[model samples]
Each structure stands twice: as C-alpha cells, then as structure tokens.
Target: MKRPKPTRRKRQNLCADKGYDYPDVRQLLRDWGYTAHIKSRGEEQSERKQIPGYRARRWVVERTHSWLNRFRRLLIRWEKKVEN
Candidate 1:
C-alpha cells in the first residue's frame, strides 16, 4: 500500500492570541519555521485599529463568503450524485 505524502502549508505565519506567547510556544513556532504573530500580555492593540486602511484585508474574506453564498448548491448541497 502506498502512503500519501503530507501536504505542506503554504502560509508560514502563525497568528495567535496572547495566551500562546509563552517561551515554549515561541520556541515551537521557531522550530517549525513559522513566524509567530502572537500578542504579548499588556501589549497595545495593533495598528490595524489605529489605521483604518489596514482593515481592508477583512473585506476580502467577507467578499469571498458572499460570492460563495450566491451558489445555491454550495450553500445547500441538493445533488444526489457524489461527483455532482
């Protein structure tokens, strides 16, 4: 039996909350070659809040969801055939 190879992650950044800012967690992220974006305790809110322009990225996600919702089959799969 041939085992399937694991798929590599394309994005290298690891975004997390302050809870993951521990030293061990940071070391783990470094070992995996991921750039950690974890927030530290008492750290002020990022520039995303101060600068409104930075929030434009969120629209991309919202727009994609809206576009997908336009497809009735994607919203609710009514096709009986698995390949349909």
Candidate 2:
C-alpha cells in the first residue's frame, strides 16, 4: 500500500503502544519499511528501557477531562453522530 504512495507523495511512519509488540506486527512493519516505535511488553526485554511519552500526554488529557466534566451535555455524550 505504501510502496505505491512513495512515487506520488511522502510516506508517513505509524506509532503504536505496547499492544502491537508481537513479532508478526514488527515484521510486517519492517517489510513495509516502517520504523517501529512500539514499546516492548515482556520480562526478557533489555534492561535499558526507553521512557514512553504516553504517560505524560495522558496527564494532559486527564486535566482536560476534569475541566470538561463541568458541562453536563459533554460528559453524557448527548450528540447522536460522533462526527458532529
């Protein structure tokens, strides 16, 4: 899919969390020429670990949720269509 796009436009890298850590997922990404940035989830992984930014970004969303909860409609998901 991405191979054809490189001829027309620039290809983009995909990001994922720990859920997509399986060997098959990583292999598919490699075969497609993508740089995997997924965090590993196993005891046998390297001792030196890279800190994930998702935890810090989650704090920002928590703060936003705290602020938004003040509105009853927004908290209840009153909108019929999500696109709205």
Number of the predicted model whose TM-score against the real structure is largest = 2
lDDT of 2 at 42: 62
The local lDDT score (0 to 100) that residue 67 gets in candidate 2 is: 79
Compared to the true structure, candidate 2 yields what TM-score?
Answer: 0.43
Candidate 2 per-residue lDDT, tens place, 6-84, comes to 2224444768988898899988877766767887776324433454432335788988887777685674676755877
Q: Which of the numbered candidates is closest to the native, going by highest lDDT? A: 1
**How many steric clashes between backbone atoms does each model show?**
0, 0
**Which stretches of model 2 miss by more than 4 angstroms?**
1-13, 42-57, 73-84
Superposition-based RMSD of candidate 1 using all C-alpha atoms, in angstroms: 10.0
| Residue-level error in angstroms, candidate 2, position 22 | 0.8
Which RMSD values do the candidates have, in order? 10.0, 8.9
Q: Write the per-residue lDDT of candidate 1 for residues 18-60, one digit (tens) a residue.
A: 8788999999877766778988865645655786665456888
- Model 1 scores what on Cα lDDT? 0.73
Candidate 1 residue runs with Cα over 4 Å from true position: 1-11, 45-84
Locate the minimum summed-lDDT window of 10 residues in model 1.
3-12
